[model samples]
Target: MNCRPRIRASLLASCLVLTVSSACGGGEAPHSAAVGGSPAAVVVAISDADRAAAKQTFETVCFTCHGVSGKGDGPGSAGLDPKPRDLSDKTWQASIGDEHLRNVITMGGAAVGKSPAMPPQPQLKGNPKQLEALIQHVRGLAR
Candidate 1:
């Protein structure tokens, strides 16, 4: 009942980023990688409820490698070889499809032909919604 406004603001910002990520032609993931252009842009203005869920998931699950801004400079990136991809970089980020991102997260980087440093999240196997949220969070980082 007494949360800090700054924390709330940060969560909102993260939500906005994820919404834009999903809207930016990333498709619904799972073999869908096309950036659909302007129509997708409109969806970037997603509801706060969606952002809250995406932001919370990212903070707890991905902040280690992707960091708060998804810049791949988290505390866990020190000894990595290829280094974590900067999720916030639009160009490099664009090269990766939403499904590819999902694969990398759920099945790890090796599953999607990426680094071994990026471990797979088998625990999320049965949770389709959470996996989707993670993908959206990755997409949001691009924004």
Candidate 2:
């Protein structure tokens, strides 16, 4: 069985969804508008597919340095000067805000005066759904 084709196809589909969503302004916004002047603050649920994609992305991309459990002890972190952050740290998680997380994730750690080893994910700047899914996934690791 050739798993490469399946993996390629899944990646292609995910990329298509991301491209289409960005092109169609599928970023953050209310699912429906309210009857009043301002929009409602209804929480949008993350689909299982998106959640799975986020997990895959984290494993493939971030896991190189952050590890599968976000312990900052991945194989790639061995050579890094400053170790990657442990995502499950309750104190650290409580100290940061979502916006700060978003900024660091999108603009890299150095952008927020953190570690320069954390590369910026410019691709996620336009895809709020995936970005938010990744953020939520990180938040879920809090221990």
Model 2, position 82: C-alpha lDDT score: 85
Give the alpha carbon lDDT tens digit for every residue of 4-97 in model 2: 2222324444344554344213443323323243222212345788799999999999999999999898889999988999998989998886
Predict model 1's lDDT versus the native: 0.62
The C-alpha TM-scores of every prediction are 0.61, 0.69
RMSD (Cα, Å) of model 2: 11.6
lDDT of 1 by residue, 1-143 (tens): 11111234234443455545542224343222234331111122345565677688788767788788999888888888898888899998767665566557778888778898888888754544465566676777777
Candidate-wise lDDT, in order: 0.62, 0.71
Q: List the pairs of residues colliding in candidate 2.
A: none
**Per-candidate clashes, comma-separated:** 3, 0
lDDT of 2: 0.71
TM-score of 1: 0.61
Cα-based RMSD of the predictions, in order?
12.0, 11.6
